[model samples]
Target: MARSPKDVSAHFSDVAEVYHDLRTTDQEPIISIKNQLGHLLYKPSINAADIGCGNGRYSLLLPQHLGDRLRLTFADKNRCMLNMLTKRLDHTCSSEVIQSSAECIPVCEKSFDFATAFNAVHHFKLKDFLAEMARILKDGGLLFIYTRTQEQNRCNIWGKYFPDFCKKETRLWKERDFCRVVAQTSQFALQDSVYFTYRRVSSLERLIEQAEGHHYSTFWLYSDKSFREALDRFQQNITAQFTDPAKIQWTDENTLFVLKKIREAR
Candidate 1:
């Protein structure tokens, strides 16, 4: 059965702590986004929001690149996830944590200078979320989406061991499909699309631990019997394929889309 949007949010709420513990902000993508934003002039106050900002991983990193003037809003539907972010960020003046879904952001339209959704778009009704983003962003405001396409997910190491992982995550958009969706929005123009690749080296034991902890939402969709069977197969594959678990490397690929809101005519 396909999980509804509410079910997806609930799953994240259930594993909020574990997800935060296992996830880290990828610095490479951060640098890529920072470079793209370099051409824009910095303002005394920059209004930014991170939709589905899980545990404030990316939010915490924004101040460095966006400067101290960044007033960030971290929005997520799961209260547990928002609570985690609040605790980690300590409710500073520079940041506000809001419990809201991406489909209907609670902010005023054209109020933000920048917006981002990091690996969170798949959880949303993409069309509504994109339109909401366009409405909320100031004219020329940038929206950055950092997510894995279905193709990228299929190429990951998890897909090799757990075939169902890719199959079950059919909600992920392909790159071309994503481009088409942006075109359909008509409120935003695609500025740039880039793929960032990184090598993730981990022990088979640790990888198994992450899977058991449901580090990725896809793992939450697995039935107990299926998860156990897949884990066993994954273990066997690792044992047969690699002599040393420490030497095992997985390729992590992420696609970033930089879109800018079109200015309204007076």
Candidate 2:
């Protein structure tokens, strides 16, 4: 069975450093997410919150996109992750860090102009988290959610090589389901939904190292025996299919949902 969100958060605290190292790589998909956010509206003295802001990767870019005009609050359930983020920012004046869960954000109601969650929603209690987001967002405020839907995950290169990848990621919401949840709230209107594709090419050796490191949360759920067996199969498959271990390629597919708060809560 999969662990509860609280348990998962605790586990992440233990592996925060490894998680940061694996995810902070100069990947094209990550770059694209940042670029897309840059295209959105940014104004002077705007307040923003990044929920579940692991290691502050996406939040760190907001300053560059919105300049000193942006005041940011980074929130996460994991204290260790928050501590790492604070150290990374070196306690910048423009930002504050809070240890809070997504279901109950520790901020005043209608306090933020913008909010974001990158690949973190699957771990949340969806209904409660969305309600909290609705409560915290100012009228006309925007919310950006970037994640890989179950459909997209099934199409990933890892799914092809590791047979259990898709099965283990059953918690991920489909694109249609995500859209419906936002629309059903009647508090947000869908502004835009975009699908992005990026190609990642890396040495097979490096890929195996990432797998062994349990870079993804899904990998953490696998038992030791299952993880080792999967890795062995993945390596064998790569060796048999590719002529060179240095030229392995994979497709990364993601969806970015842009939503606008349309009206004040009744």
Candidate 3:
């Protein structure tokens, strides 16, 4: 089951102290964000916001990639996440941290040149967050959303082997619906969409550790007893399918959607 807003916020807060250790970067978003930003016409300064920036997984390394011209704001609902992110940052880049939710960002209208959400949208109320983005982004500002769609989620190794993993993560967006929602808002125009597939190699023991640690929020949705049963089955399935417990391989896929603010929100 999808967790409520309060539960999700609490879940992140509970894990904030060890977020960097528990969460896998899945895909390095800095490369993708930097490449997309590079294609744009050069701007003297880029005011960017990393919404739902949990522990600064993606935004922390962005300053080095884009240089001093990148002004960043890290926003998330959990104060603990922002605090953890603060320790990781060296204060070399011009940045700000805001305690705010994705659905209601507290910032001046049309304030940002760009906004990016990586692996964070599934926790948001999609339309409300889109509306907030439309309100806060300047005309021509870009929005980069990197997430796993329902189809792409099914391709994950856990989805294939972990019992009911896919069925429990019902909050993911469908690709068609995702594009349609952006277009229907009229404040943004879809620019491009692409799929990024990464080959993952991990030992069975490591996978179990991550699962037991509840590295992903999806695991939090499972009851303790249910998760225990599933973990046992997941381990057995992996051992039976793979020739070597230490050399299991699979592909994980995620999508990136690029949209541009077409007009000012009324």
On TM-score, the candidate that comes out on top is 1
Ranking by TM-score: 1, 3, 2
Model 2 error, position 66 (Å): 1.1
Model 2 segments more than 4 A misplaced: 1-9, 24-42, 91-93
lDDT of each: 0.82, 0.78, 0.85
User: What is candidate 2's lDDT per residue for 59-99, written digit by digit as tens?
Assistant: 78767656677788899989878878877895443888889
For candidate 3, the TM-score is 0.93
Q: What does each candidate score in C-alpha RMSD? A: 2.6, 3.2, 2.8
* 1-266: candidate 3 lDDT, tens digit per residue: 34442244467777788778865675456677777775452887888999999899888777877788888999998888898998998888899899999999889998998899988998898889989999899888889998999899888889999999889888889899888888788788888887788898989988988887677788887877788899999999999999999989999898889888897546
On a 0 to 1 TM-score scale, where does candidate 1 land against the true structure? 0.93
- The global Cα lDDT (0 to 1) of model 1 is 0.82
In angstroms, give how far residue 92 of model 3 lies from its true place.
1.1
Off by over 4 Å in 1: 1-9, 39-41, 90-93
lDDT of candidate 2 vs native?
0.78
